[model samples]
Target: MSASASEGPVECGGDEFKTDKNLRTSLSGLPSKIVAGSGFHGFKLNVKNTGDRAYQRVDFGVFAAQVDEEDYFIDTSHLTLQYKDPASGTWKAISLDETDEGAGYLGYTDVKAHESFSIDLRLAVDKSAPAGLGYAISIGMYADDEGNCVFSGDGSYYEFDILKAGTAPGDPGNAKPQGGKKPLPQHQPAGNTKIEPQGHLAQTGSSSALPAIALAGGAAVALGAGAVFVVRRRRNADSGTAA
Candidate 1:
């Protein structure tokens, strides 16, 4: 979406327009903590239209304020905002218009009925940003460039922290072994013995000599039985001849 520079200052009918219940907005993918002076962090803002009619010339803006003190606006001059262009699939800078209501407005086109759209946003917190908690960003949506209508419910706020330089959560140096215990040693093979591969016959504990021995035993038994049978037959024949 492109900014409407030619259009004069946007008047969002501050506090006069009722909150539109048909629209819903949400913010996600924001990191809970960020390092000051780091590169830009990416997040997403989504808007859904539950109403039957399409919203034309819709606009949304970003503003930051300290928690518990909404009236005291934080200086976001060091912050840079960029939105990904859906058509080109490339990131483009969004023009921030300083409004009288202390919010920076970015122009958007329309939200069709029963349709939802998402904007991928990248925010850079410069090194000048104070490292602490209680920092929050609010998004506001307005209908029509003339600002006749404002969508109150179609906005949300998210809170995050700015960390000091070279500091991050869950540092490895700060980690301690659990329950004061040492890790178990890894398994290793014993001593410098070389392992040789065995053949399939050796694996089964069988050898060629085993089958040969069995066959020789069987043949010897058969030969002894045949000799006894032949001797008995000759003895019967000789007895018959003598009779």
Candidate 2:
């Protein structure tokens, strides 16, 4: 019960302030999976101002899987894409006014102590974006205080996989995970075969002609036999001339 034991650590105004134990800061209800090649899809981030006081300016980031290449904090030249005003409970799309370094920062005037606030982001997937299976998208948060700004403890990061397009809903194709090699072709080529077949000339008169010649010979033999029988009958009639 000494005075020193009774006094807990003092809270600093900047990013150095210890997070409120009861004050929960989290991001759920995300898209869970984003198709890699789909057009602009809406994504939401729920940021609850759980601290004792409202946050004046909090900087957040949206990053891909590879954080090494992502510069959401350093580069803010891109369009705002989305923002919500805490007072009106309405959301608005922020046009890119300037390409300055501070453009990436989403500034809020006052986020109430117990109330919750959220920002919906609409990020377009590059037309030729690679597919993702395990961990595709990542999100980070940093409280903007002057002194402790770039420090590590001021940030929170989350990782998620991108839902690949060209896949039927509830039907997950065996697409290679992001960062994986392409699958080999399954069918082998039919060697030396033409894709389009050439028209074959009918055997011309080769086969049909022989059969026709045989038929003509058969008819001649039949006519010769008939002539011989008629001659014999005419001779018999001559022998019986008087009768």
Which structure among the candidates has the greatest lDDT?
1
* TM values, all candidates: 0.54, 0.39
Query: Where in model 1 is the C-alpha error above 4 Å?
Result: 1-14, 65-73, 95-103, 134-147, 171-243
Q: Of the candidates shown, which would achieve the greatest TM-score relative to the real structure?
A: 1
Q: Over the stretch 41-156, how does candidate 2's per-residue lDDT look in tens digits?
A: 45555455444654332333233221112221211122124544433445544332222222223332223455454555555444344444222121212223322221112123
Which residue pairs collide, candidate 1?
A: none
- 144-168, model 1: which lDDT tens digit per residue? 3343434436333455666766676
User: Candidate 2 — which residues are off by over 4 angstroms?
Assistant: 1-25, 65-104, 133-156, 163-165, 169-243
- Residue 149, candidate 1: Cα error in Å is 1.6
